[model samples]
Target: MPQFAELRRRVIQGGEAHFITSLTRCVRWAQRGGKSNAYFAKTRDDRFIIKSLNKAEKASFLRFAPAYFEHMVKMLSGQRTCLAKLLGVFTVTFKPTAGGGLSAATGSSSGPNEGLDLLVMENSFYGRP
Candidate 1:
């Protein structure tokens, strides 16, 4: 969470909107990829995709977040590119409920193996008809 706090600061300072995730409202409805070991889900509004990240992937993300953030800033602000913009990175603990919804995590006290690491990206085709 501290890392996210810092990331949020950097994102906003770089002229991008900061996205705060609500795991309670998101639904992980699909799994994708094989060797990549990635699962894909969308926000309830279908505006973003949440991708699961393994430990190594998460580490790589954090290591390059500064450069990635800058790349996103440029790509989103009129630069032409086929790359999807990363909206946020988060670690969340999801305890399943009877209705199949996730219980809210209270704080950042969860251990590394106890939570899900995720990358949030804008859905490039979200507005397509």
Candidate 2:
């Protein structure tokens, strides 16, 4: 995840703190005509966009992730590519608490407690005038 950390540090203002803070406050982002039932949310800080992906989409991305990192290293022209700067992909799940309650905190996105598969990318409109 060093490459991912590099991407985060390069594009964001701070480290993990900034990222967590950004996600702490987000608003539902409107759909711009996609055929999937994915959910979209824009960080209130306006630095990133979170898209919930289906199982199939998530699997597809994971399959080509190694190649993606390779290709990203070649993005040196400072121009936006067709694919936005994808920061990371992960799942956020809820875990059962000590009291047998589901915690709002994120956990493993797999297993019996299925969670959302998310794609976090740099906000295309970030830093816009």
- The Cα local distance difference test for each model comes to 0.66, 0.79
Report the C-alpha lDDT of model 1 over 52-97, residue by residue, as the tens digit. Answer: 9999999988898777666756755667778776767777775555
TM-score of 1: 0.63
What is candidate 2's CA lDDT for residue 81? Answer: 58
- Given candidate 2, what's the lDDT at residue 46? 90
- The local distance difference test score of model 2 is 0.79
Which sections of candidate 2 miss by over 4 Å? 76-82, 95-102, 105-111
Candidate 2 has a TM-score of 0.78
**lDDT: worst 10-residue window of model 2:** 105-114
Top candidate, metric lDDT: 2
